[model samples]
Target: MIILGIDPGIADTGFGVISAEKSTFKAITYGTIKTSKADDLAKRLDYLYKDIEKLIKKHKPSKIGIESIFFAKNAKTAITIAHARGICLLAAQQAKAQIHEYTPLQIKQALTGYGAADKNQIQQMVKTILNLKEIPKPDDAADALACAICCAQTKQYV
Candidate 1:
């Protein structure tokens, strides 16, 4: 199965694509969609929407896995991220892909066998699972990959 994972943000949205069969995983693509702070919030969301649409078109993933919005200290920041996430969901819907949402704890648990695992641990697991030369970059990208890995693991158990 080909899965597209998303770590949503207004400034730097992360995306990862992976093909998984049983316990095997192949990393297809991983990157961040960056928007300038100079741009308006609406424009940043538009950029995210367009970029995600392009990714869905290019890869034609069977499903999309996205990080669920976690409460942050800053309410404004959370709201902004929520907006971006909404657009991301819309993009997946438009692409006609099955969507699944996972929490950060769930992703870490799936990848590293520890619900409280740190970022480094999760990234290391992602690299090892995919047999990559290096950890996926830009933190957000790694998180996105972790989400995809979480979905793959969940599918296996189910």
Candidate 2:
């Protein structure tokens, strides 16, 4: 099964594509879609939606896993993230992909067996699980991969 994972943000949205079969996982691609802060919110969201839609079209993933907002530093930050996440969901829905939402705690616990796992732990787990030569870079990409792994590890998929 092809699965797409997303770590959404207004400035840099991370994405990972994986093919999962039983207990095996192969990384198809992973990267970040970046938007310039110089642009206004509307422009940035437009760019985000278009890029995400392109990814969905290219991958044709059967399932999409997205990170849900668990905590935010401020109301503004939470609102912005909600906007970005909404775009992600819309893109997934438009593609008719089965969407699964995971909170940060859920993703961390799924990957590391501990809900309080640190970033480095999750990154290492993502690398080790996929047997990648090195950790997925830029932090966000790793987090997206972790989300994918979590989704894939779910009993329904396994």
lDDT of each: 0.92, 0.94
Q: Please give each candidate's TM-score.
A: 0.96, 0.97
Task: Choose the strongest candidate by TM-score.
Answer: 2
Q: Judge candidate 2 against the unseen true structure and give its global Cα lDDT, from 0 to 1.
A: 0.94
TM-score, prediction 1: 0.96
Candidate 2 global TM-score = 0.97
In model 1, pairs of residues that clash are none
- Candidate 2: residue 45 lDDT (0-100): 96
Model 2, 21-126: lDDT tens digits are 9999989999999999999999999999999999999989998999999999999999999999999999999999999999999999999899999999999999
| Candidate 1: residue 78 Cα off by (Å) | 0.5
